[model samples]
Target: MNEQPPGRRLGRGLAALIGDVNSPTPEPANQLAPDRTVPIELVSPNPRNPRRGFDEADLIDLAQSIQKHGVVQPVVVRPSPDQSGRYEIVAGERRWRAAQRAGLAELPVIVRDVDNRTALELAIIENVQRADLNPVEEARGYQQLIDEHGYSQADLGQVIGKSRSHVANTLRLLKLPDVVHDMLVSGTLSAGHARTLVTADNPAEVARRIAEDGLSVRQAEALAQTPAAERPSISRSAPAAKDADVLLLEKKLSDAIGMRVTIALKGNVGELKLVCRSLEPLDELCRRLGQG
Candidate 1:
């Protein structure tokens, strides 16, 4: 049994609500009066954990720290719905894994009686707050919440303490193709580069160039904005020109929204086009235009 004083109730603050394992001042997510310390074997990792990849070197370092000085904070878990006498980890998976690597028999835990929704929310919040999830993982988590729980961008932003626009932009990374996704997950492409390539004519080809040339985000955006036929290929000529004033306006708009903007004018009766690769960017553009 976990050691604790009688009637030592935990609070429902964000630290507790989010299951911050590394919280300097730990607290509980609810009014649950008691906390328990369970055997490490009984505590299974959450399969739905938003954080997918863990750096092996960092894990080793964490294990060494645990070996020197045991787990400072307790992991948060919930009763497993599928198995009796088993618990599912809601947060602090890294700590638990490190403890196991450090050869620990048991560790402290706070077993909350939260439902599936709360469990997923807590896991996402914990990973996001700690900056543990990578760009792909972060976007996937947001998408999962939106898809599985019917969470709107505004609702997710409110819950995660972010602006809806920020949440929307982060979620846009998922529109990247498989090649770009691998590049992003492996750190070959930055979030900025990935976002710029979303609407490109050939994202995989452009992503290859970006990686081969070590192009910056701005450079990638410039390359993506260029017409495919006039992209300086060995077989292609230069691109057609627009009016100088129209070009200037397009540049301004593109810079403002971090995406491509185009204007076509025949006699002040032409169209203004804002090109967005995904719903997130479209939402961002709409928000900027005060239309969202």
Candidate 2:
């Protein structure tokens, strides 16, 4: 007997379940047209899906919540092509399943008249911006954007308010061995730890150390940082300011820019220098300082 891989199986099942991944979107009625509002029936959701388990008891509780508070967020949906009037959920599976469990017949949904490209992009942006989406969901969303929507990391970065390198780095995290990914997704590991592990030939070993050692982000960065064959000793620091005003100004600048600012006093003249971790941070600091 042959068995389909999990990814392949998931894809096949989803394909068979809905005409389009975004088909669950509901269409709004046009006042100009006589024909408006299509009929959609409640259907049993597939249990095998990796999404979530919607409890009936929980649903009753949610129904009470909805009855009291109403639907704060709109459910996402896609139109039905096989049936005359039906829609499937691209996202918000839990809400739909809960609404059904709550004994609600119809859900207020936005029917996005969008193709695959628009659908995946919007879904990714919404999930990423909301900050509710977990790393795995985010990774999946990014993968969908690239595979289905023809988006590069640069495109995704712009869409999600992240730098292109950020997107690329995050995607690379997905390539870590499944064990490492499991640790990442389960919160046993951090993005920084995973990033450092990328340099290791055996990431599993690094992941094991991360789990057992409980490495801090700084510690992980230290391990990841290049080790010099002959380490140089850092010189002792001395305050450059001769007077209180100059020291106060350096501290003030540091606080305002959220970085370390140093004033080196040599005789009558003092050199002001700002140190930052990255270009974006430096640029942002410069912009604020320039404004002041």
The best candidate by lDDT is 1
Off by over 4 Å in 2: 1-64, 224-292
TM-score of 2: 0.55
Residues 70-150, model 1: lDDT tens digits: 775668888998999999998789888888999999878877788887788778866876667888898999899889977
* Per-residue lDDT of candidate 2, residues 242-265 (tens digit): 578877988998898767898878
Q: Each candidate: what lDDT?
A: 0.75, 0.56
Please give the lDDT score for candidate 2: 0.56
Q: By TM-score, how accurate is candidate 1?
A: 0.70
